[model samples]
Target: MQNVTVKNRNWDIAAHMYFPEPFDQSKKYSAIVCVHPGSSVKEQTAGLYAEKLAQTGFITLAFDASFQGESGGVPRYLEDPATRVEDIRCAVDYLTTVTFVDENRIGVLGICAGGGYAANAALTERRIKVVGTVVATNAGRAFGELNPLQTLEAVSKQRTAEARGADAMITSWTPDSAEEAERAGLAEFDMLEAIDYYRTPRGSYPTSCNKLRFTSMSALITFDAFHYAERLLTQPLMVIVGDKVGAFGSYRDGFDLYNKAASSNKRIHVVHGASHYDLYDQPEATGQALEKLIPFYKENL
Candidate 1:
């Protein structure tokens, strides 16, 4: 039930800390650094998950990734896989120093796109003992050259140009603008259950820098968050996905790809009939996802 500022390498970020009712400063509680989906902030499903997890004798943190929402950074709303991964580590660093938190037992849970980034972050940051991804995505593979038509070579060339002093522009892939939603051309991409989830009053919240800078294409095209999947991650990990998601098959493949190299106990669970967004804020569905997570963290972290 508090808001604190975490200073990162880039800027000072704002985050809401939900302490369990009847707060006990004498008790060192376990914690979960809840990471939101791409283009999302603490007020969205990320906060919902953090609150639920906090209620179960765990301290949870829901934060806005840098350059988005309430967090700080210039050129706003850009998605840098490298810095986004650091945001998670920065949150963990902040958590470990806070009062009444058992830093050693702290873990993380990322929803949607955040899930993939969390997995990648855990690979290098051994400080995280237990990691969980909800409605996981292989952003790198999907956004990368996972499709032969979208060759990695083309993306790499763009990145190389940027590294050589080209302008930095990031483009947003979110459908958060009503006008943009109308033109989303859903016929082309039905992977999202509903366009409104990313647009309209249902979820869209507008801001000038809310979208990614087109220049970030350089970083994104060449940036594969799970670049080191086969190694680095040795902690207990959990992957939760909606059983009937439109992209369920892809998620399954991503899970299979990483599970092969994860050097620790791991699990994969499917929530029946729970589509992608359903796991985002659906009360019952999110509850189920957490139901699996609570036990997993209890045993692992």
Candidate 2:
């Protein structure tokens, strides 16, 4: 494994490049770009998957989105969907430049909200041959579900504040504590578990700060991750979501992507007994997911 920087427009994307064991530089290898979840850094689940994929003999990269984690951009912690999509394209641009990468066999894998960005990126980025998403969360739809009028009004106020020279307002992407999460109505078992995962010693990291610019809400509410799936998302696609996640409407976006994609080859794999957050780092559940992903990429990429 090596730390690398990928040049993406004005930002230098900080990433971890995982090379397969017994790697042979003389032989070309397929590569997968692993995208991290929103309110997440590349050091978490994205890196986990990238490392596992590399173990399967594919060169993989897990990168921080511009303005988040270690990547460079103005307005730190801003979560702009458009820029996130562009980051994936930039990762692809970097991958194509590597001499040992098989350009024709490049693939992409995204987790959580990153799944949405990956799907969006794959729509117009034809260089990506196959795409995979785990526990996909459509950010637009998720934010839109908040009290519509109140959310919009708040975002509008924040925009005004920013224009008037006020500092960028920052907000916690997730509750900072279990009590706060519960107070915010994240009382479900899975929801509580997710809070713990991001906020506690279980999975917390210095770079995974779980904060975002309040102004980002405006763009996030308007951006659709699967904007043109019916027409432009033609590549082979795989959607993996925990079966239990469907009960909470979290998996609906994944199913929607599978249903709307024009790809002749597309499928959804439901990991049994796993919840939305369980797929983030659970060994057994993640193992099951990779079981499907490995073969899917092998057959498609």
Candidate 3:
């Protein structure tokens, strides 16, 4: 894997580019952009999928979003959905300039909320030949529990406070540890799994900050990543979801995408016994996902 930086507007997105074993720069190759879940960095699950896909003879890129991880942005840890969608497009822009990449054969794969961003971007970015999602979380809907008007009001106040020299409000996406989660009565299956994967050595990385800027929540609550998907998302699409759906609701979002997409060539795969977080890094679960993804990209891209 080669570390690289992709330019998204003014920000430099930190990324890892994975080359197929025995790679030949003289030959053109299909490329896949692997997008990480929300609150994650390129060093985590996105990087894992990129490496695995590269081993299968495809050039894959895993990138940190513009405002999070190791990427460049002001108000670090912000999670603007619109900018997240644009980040995917910027990754594609970088891929198009590579000497060995077959620009026509580029595809995208996104995990969790990143999946939602991929779908949203593909609606307008026709250069993405195909799209695949794993445990796709529609972030707008994920934040639906919060009333948008109320959240916006709170964000306005927070922004005003910051302008007046008040410190920014940083919020954690999960508890600091499993014990902490349990103590706080956050025992949901997906929540526990997330804590295990992100809050511990099993998957934690220094750059993977699990916190978000409070002002970012305003955009998240109002944004709908899958809006107009039925009409505009016409690319060849694959939606993969775990059978054991949890609070994150990626399972329902996956099915919703499959059912609503106008694409004539679309498929949905359900990984048996896998939960939302299992596909993050579990060998058996990720193996099952790639079994479907390998051929899908091979044939579609």
Candidate 4:
């Protein structure tokens, strides 16, 4: 694995590139850009998948979204949907510059909200030849399910306060830990597992602080990651989701993508009995996803 940085507009995205074991600099290889979930850094599931994919002969990259992790951006922890989508494009741009990367065979794999972002980016990024999503979560639809108008109004106020010298408002994606979730009466199976993953050493990373800028809610409430997937997302696509649906709606989102994508070749695979969070790191669940993804990328890319 090689630590790297990619230029994205004014910021530099922090990333890691995983090369095939018997890598050959003189030969071009198919490549994949692994986009991490919201509030997550490259060191988590995205990196895991990239490393695994590299082992199977594909050069892969896992990157931190701008403003989060170690990526360069101000007003840190912002989760702007548009920026996230653009970050995927920038990652692809970086891959295209690598001498060993096959430009025409580039693909993307997104986990959770990153899945939605990847789909959105591929809608216009013709350079992305294939798309794969794991436990896809459409951020707009997920956050829109809340009282979006109310949240947007609050976000407006928060942004104004921050502009006026107030401290940036921040919020966590989940309760700090399983104990906290239990105390807070959060009993959703997926939610509890998310707490266990993000707040514990099991999947936690220093750069993944779990913090999100409160003002980002405004954009997330309005951004539609699948705005024109039916018309513009024409690349071969694969959607993977766990059987256990969660409050975050990844299961639904996966099916929705499979149905809406314009790709002539598209599929949705279910990892039996796995919850959304399970696909993030559970070996059985992730292995199931890779079983499908490996062949899908090979055949498509």
Compared with the true structure, what per-residue lDDT tens digits does model 3 show for residues 1-301? Answer: 9999899888799999999999999999999999999989998999998999999999999999988888998878899999999999999999999999999999999999999999999999999999999998899998876577888899999999999999999999899988888899988889999999999999999988788898998889888888999999999998989999788899999999888888999999999999988999999999999999999999998
lDDT of 2: 0.90
Comparing 1 and 4 by TM-score, which wins?
Answer: 4
Per model, state how many residue pairs clash. Answer: 11, 0, 0, 0
Q: Which residue pairs collide in model 2, if any? A: none
Pairwise lDDT winner, candidates 1 and 4: 4
Against the true structure, candidate 4 reaches a TM-score of 0.98
lDDT of 1 by residue, 1-301 (tens): 6898887886977788888776899998888888887667888878888888878778888888888888899767777888888999999999989989898888988887788788888888888888888886666555554354354455566667878987654555655444564576532232344455656466555532346665455565665656667777778878888776463344564466356546568888888878788888778888899899999988877
The Cα local distance difference test for each model comes to 0.74, 0.90, 0.92, 0.92
Error of 4 at 264 (Å): 0.3
lDDT of 1: 0.74
Greater-lDDT candidate between 1 and 2: 2
Clashing pairs in 3: none
Candidate 2 per-residue lDDT, tens place, 204-270, comes to 9999898888878888888899888999999999999987853235589989999999999999999
Off by over 4 Å in 3: 147-149
Clashing pairs for predicted structure model 4, backbone only: none
lDDT digits (tens) for residues 25-88 of candidate 4 = 9999999999999989999999999999999999999999999998998868889998899999
